[model samples]
Target: MAGGVAAAVLGAIGGAGAYAYAGEVPRGTSVLGVDIGGKNRSDAIAALHAGLAKQAGKLGNPVAVRLGDRAAEVTPADIDLGVDVEATVTVAIEASPNPIGRLLGSRTVEPVVTLDEGKLHDLLGTALGKDARAMKQPSITFSGTTPKPNYPQPGRGLDAARSADAVRSGWLGGGPVDVPIVEIHPATTKEDVDKLVAEFARPAVSAPVTVTTERGDVTVAPAAIAKSLRLVADKAGRIEPALDAKKLRAALSTPLGAVEVQPKDARVAIVSGKPRVTEGTEGRQVDVTALATDLLAVLPKSDERTVTGKLVAAKPATTAADVAKLGIKERVSTFTTKFTGGLGAPRSQNIVQIAKDVDGTLVKPGAVFSLNGHTGERGYRQGYRDAPVILDGKLVPGVGGGTSQFTTTLFNAAYYAGLEDVHHKPHSYYFDRYPAVIESTIFWPDLDMKFRNNTEYGVVIDTSWTDNSITVSMYSTKVWDSVSTEYSPRRNITSPKVIKLPKGPTCIATNGIPGFTQDAFRVFKKDGKVVEREKFTWTYSAEPRFTCG
Candidate 1:
């Protein structure tokens, strides 16, 4: 009994010692593979820090997550990957809570790893978001000259929540962890896309098409079809093929214009002292929509390779019947202006050319005729050459210089024809070649001799020129018995300024002329009775005569 008493006392003493020691972790206890056995709180936490540092090293190197050829890297340190050191120490303490239990079993305390998923998302976004587009299901494309199609792509997307969970779950475990990426499926599947492609896009681009009309033929080669066709997705997620009309029309515009006959307005002229009109002919035009439809239809089966669609006839803007309704019966009024036959032969040739240009123009009632418009741009193109023209009160060599002779002649004819003068500019200086105040001068673009045909009948102008002379006559039904011009004597005359020229053969000698202001009355008489009388006034500037030094 005494021995048993002694053994019980010894056991009690040993139990107290063990209880004091068991406050610390038991042997073989580790935090993420780092042994923390027999360590104090501070020492165990330091050991956990070392273990986390090792894990960080393993995760720092790039492990790329790839989709097709695209890849993004995940860095553990960038994501704030770390261990919960305090919590890990608490777990170690809990493992050894009871002295008896601590001595009985081995324990391993796993350190909780921490990370910022927002950081991960940011890093990945920059790396991966560049080429991530919503899938265009069953997209049609061209491979060389042939039409090629692709199946619907189940696109890839980043799932931050799932990725964060995975990274957390796998942190303790060692090895490479693949990033979790969500697959974004298209609205249509591969089978549906394939069927639609086969039905529309594939067949449309499979063969060449030819368009034919009575006028000509146009071939739409396979290469053109690839550029012209498009595939679009509908609300129901169906892929449908359609021709890009804008692109197709642009492609065919040049070819269509080449084969088509452009429309022309009817031309009017006086024949045999009466108004004569030439009938306008209809021209061929391609129907764009019809051609597209026919080509789409015949491309699949027709062996002729020839799409048959007749060209539509287009009507002209003016026809022969339109011109005949104008009442251009007889001479309305007539006048002839005479010029000296041997002065400025160059000017005479220009007068003849201008006459021919204005001859066929028909002036409708109340319509104004532009001398510059009828004469067009004058140069070598219209067969005009350099001649004498008055510029800054001096004669200078210029193109279309002699056209003023025709202008005066035409103006007088229209003047007696009872036409209203809309615009006219007289010469700056008085010259024997043109009548003062009543004559008109012409330049291109800015200045013109315009007159409105006020009478109900259309007027046909007739002009002809001889060597060193020009005469313009108006031919129309007689609106007045007679028309005559009365002129005022030259007044306000200024002495001509003399200009000395440098030694040159190109210099021209001119006679000094005085500038004057004059007035004229154009009187229209019907059966010996006074009718309309219009007064015209002019102010001329003195011109300096040039003398070669």
Candidate 2:
């Protein structure tokens, strides 16, 4: 009985000792490189904050996150990736539960981290904006004569949740945190593109398709089909076929001309040196869009491809009312430039041809007229003959040489009509025949003269030519009562250089002209008062004298 009593007392004493030891922290305990052994809960927390202050400060700043080769910085406060000091100490205290184990061994506790997924996600989006790549879907475009396909490509984006967790665990280490990147796949795969090409794009251009309209049947060739057909990806990246109705109409215009009643646009025709408006007429037009849709339905078929189209009444693009609204009734300005070439001369013929092409052109209000845009290449095919043209400071026989004479006349007419000059370049050498510092030259598409009709009324251009001169007149509502020019005295005059060349078909003799700088001021008058004055300046290069041996 005495031994039993002694055993009970010893057990009670041991239990009391365990209760005292558990009140304080375990010995040899460390948390985030901070030692807090044999201390209470409050003391352990204090030690953790004091010991981790420097490391926590480093983490509080910006932490660099690397996404492949691209890197961005993230502030701990911005993303909510940080440690909970009180919670960390509690975890360290609970790490060693057994009384004997806590007394005998050392424990290293991980810092408790706090991370808000919403904040982290937004922060990552801003930080890694450039590094994030978007996926591209497959598509086929009809930009060229044939269809060209753009293949699908994969993209990359950050794995936000995983990266945030990584930062929470690894940020305390004070180095660049590696972000996880995931591949983003496009909805339209490469296999889908291959299928589209084989199923539609390739077969659509394999043969010609005939479309029958109310007028007659028009055949669409394979090249035309290739130009009109387009394989595009929709919003969901699904490949679909489409047709360009405008291009299809252009291809079938010639064949359908015989069967269709075409509408005539309103135009101005010069009569007795006066403006006459010709009324437009409406006609039955083919429904090209519906016709193209029917053609697209049978483009993939190899045999018996034909469809019927409907005809509808269509109005002219420009009506008689449109022309009447322009208020073009009387002549506003006229200019004439005389040439030395007589009748049947190549230069005279060129001047007449260009004048005919530009005759009766109606320039709308606020519209710009381009000489080169109207008359493209003036090669032999365009009926321009070989004429003596100025080249390399000498006279050489070139096609469309004297067309510049027409351009100069048009420029002067536009100038006197109070039209705005968009672009014009004077001749390389001074020519007594042309008004000094006011004339312009043309060299195919490069050297062009352009003018804009800036008035509220449309301008009608009329051209008339004689054997030795060409005249251009503009008919519109006159803005100014009269327009005159004031010239500046010629300055910086230089003598011409005499050039000697062997006698051949290519060389022509010429008396060289002197170079000089001059300026002209356009005076616009309204009610006998000068309303506005615009200045124009130019420098002319001396034409070298070419002597034939």
Candidate 3:
């Protein structure tokens, strides 16, 4: 009975095979929603193309793409986005190549779409606007003059491969699909910045800078300038070196300032109608500005760091005997300056330091005395703190911030005293505490506030200060009968730019102020006649402050 049943099944299969061999297509065979059943090969091919004519006209009916309301339409034809009809037809045709398989089983062919991936890739690339930054993989770049890694910035774009796969999958699975075009994004990270900082920047501050001279070598430890060395972004938004000029100048202050000597000029005075002659002396001074320039050359070295520079001489053109015959008498000029004190602690410390250095300083006949030479270095160990210092025309925290206030005091005192002008630099910005157009700024071992004693007699410096007030008094016998001052209103006044930063852990806030330029003059009178006159100009910088979260 079992054998008979098997024979009946075999006969049924054979009959089905015979029927399939004689037939073209059974009844229902469709592809891409096009029915090709019971049709010949040529008819099926024609039907395939006709059914997909609408899909080929994808430009007219584009697939709607949306990324969080950022809508974009993509033409499938433009991207060569279409089904592989021939391959799909081959798959359909091959499904029932044998008679038994054709009659006994039914098969459905999902078209295998073929597209010009390069063109698709290009289409995806153009999907974004020029303003839309493409996602970038993390990479190292030596785009700068120096050899170092640049930190990466975040960006966004459509994911090419995954998006293509999704398009094909949707078409094959369901006809109605509003593709949720997934967005690919670059890492929103500063990890690269952190990495470079760890790998290079932090290690750079590990060793002290060895500045070698023929006489000896001086070391500026990392601790001194490390805080000043910042990983600042360049114009291209790459991390670069930000060596604080103020900090570097302050750090090199002592060693270099020690090498300088204030020149002595011959002193001559009239006493009992006899001219007394004081000897002239030679002197040496360090070229600290040049040293600052050379710092970049030697700082990033494994070994051998030495720099040599020219020293400026304070040479007296005339001897004391030569000037003695001129017959100049006492009390030429004198002036006083007052300051509002009750200062901040950092400023107070700097003021006290400067006042101590300036007091008891003597300016002799035909001689020059520099405030910097007298004060030497303003070092942290020497009572200076990381207060706000002016740098690159901006006031920021540095080692000797408030010292400039003293510069104003001494400079104005010398100016009103009818002293000879030498060299003085004014602040970049105006401060209410300082007298406008009549102020000074100093960077030790480089810039200085100097005045020459053109008078025959010597002038003495006296200083007194409280928390709320301070005074600078220059005492000398009157060479000019009186000294008076004139001034011009600020010209070329400009306002500062305000910068805003997003609210974050790195947010910082600073208030900005305006800038201007002005001039002041001192007139000296002897017997009510003008004997000498001097002029001083100040160019204040516009300080741009930051506004933050």
TM-score of each: 0.48, 0.70, 0.39
Clashes of 2: 0
RMSD over all Cα atoms, model 2: 10.9
Per-residue lDDT for 330 in model 3?
37
Lowest lDDT 10-residue stretch of candidate 2: 15-24
Query: lDDT tens string, model 1, 174-253?
Result: 65455655765667777776675566556666677777777677767776777777665663346655667677767777
User: Best by lDDT, which number?
Assistant: 2
Tens-digit lDDT string for candidate 2 (1-549): 999999999998797557536646777778767888778999888888788786766657888888677787888788677778898878876765576666567777777899887787777767668778766877986554466779888777756668778788777776788878888666788887877777777778877777677667777788887777767776456776888899877877776676678888798988887788999888887788887788778877778777787888888888878999999998999999898859689999999999989988889999999999998889899999999887776789999989988999999999999999999999998888889988999998789999999999989999998889999999999999999899999999989898889989998998888899999999999999999999999999887877999
Query: Which pairs of residues have clashing backbones in candidate 2?
Result: none
Task: List all candidate RMSDs to the true structure.
Answer: 21.8, 10.9, 22.5
lDDT of each: 0.72, 0.84, 0.64
Pairs of residues at least 3 apart in sequence or in different chains that clash in candidate 1: 330-476, 330-477, 331-476, 331-477, 331-478, 332-476, 332-477, 332-478, 341-468
